[model samples]
Target: AQSVTQPDARVTVSEGASLQLRCKYSYSGTPYLFWYVQYPRQGLQLLLKYYSGDPVVQGVNGFEAEFIKSNSSFHLRKASVHWSDSAVYFCAVTGATGGNNKLTFGQGTVLSVIP
Candidate 1:
């Protein structure tokens, strides 16, 4: 079994500011992590993911995430954010067991970009 926690319910940042969304997970053995963003009235889009290798993975929109297995964390980061970046971000973990890839999600963090 696995779980995810996003400590922040909401986050606000200036249009050009950088962003970091925290995520923590609980799982035994190897864990697969992902970051997904949902815009207003839009479906969820995969932002980034980590399963193995490099530990750091690139994502769309200049976003990236690093998997720190020892810390059980996979935090999402952006060098600079635009107003369009405002959305609800979710952290998810998928475990493959018995040929089943089950995903567990976080509560989500709503981001607000101010002009």
Candidate 2:
């Protein structure tokens, strides 16, 4: 079985500050990891993804994440955040069964950026 865990239920940050969100996963085989962001009343947009190769993956809006195989972690980071960045972030993983690419999402971390 494949699953994801997001420790933080919500995170608040001031505008122009940096941010980081934690994520962990458990899977039987090689997993495909991804981060998605959703704004108010909108669908989720892909932030970044990691299938293979580099451990670090860059995302839009100055977001990035580093994949740690040993720790089974893929944490998201941003150097500077804007007020528009305030939204909900979800960490997801896909199994290697080679069937439907259904994503298992975490509980989600709500980011509140204060101006």
Candidate 3:
């Protein structure tokens, strides 16, 4: 079975500061990883995904994630953050099988960006 975990339940950073949200997975085989962000009243939006090829993948709004196979981790990072970036970020994992792509999500890490 595949599972995802976001160690930090909440993260705070000043505006324009760099950010990194930690994510770890438990899966024997290679699994599809995703980072999704949910704004105040909106649905979850895809930040970035890692299917194959490169270890690092770029996402929207200058967000990026690196897939480290050995560590079984896929951590999200950004060079700088804005106040708008403050939201709930979720780390999800799904196995590449069957038609139904069911994603297992972490508890979610709430980001707070101070001005």
TM-score, every prediction: 0.95, 0.96, 0.96
* Lowest lDDT 10-residue stretch of candidate 1: 94-103
lDDT of 1 by residue, 1-115 (tens): 7899999999999988999999999988688889999998889999988878999899999999999888999999999999999999999998745537888999999999999
**Model 2 ranges off by over 4 Å:** none
- C-alpha lDDT (0 to 100) for residue 79 of candidate 1: 91
List all candidate RMSDs to the true structure.
1.0, 0.9, 1.0
Lowest summed lDDT window (length 10), candidate 2: 95-104
Error of 1 at 19 (Å): 0.7
User: What is the Cα-based TM-score of model 2?
Assistant: 0.96
lDDT by residue for model 2 (1-115), tens: 7889999999999999999999999987898999999999999999999988999999888999999999999999999999999999999999766959999999999999999
lDDT (tens digit, per residue) of candidate 3 on 1-115: 7788999999999999999999999976669999999999999999999999899999999999999999999999999999999999999998866536889999999999999
Q: In terms of TM-score, which candidate is stronger, 1 or 2?
A: 2
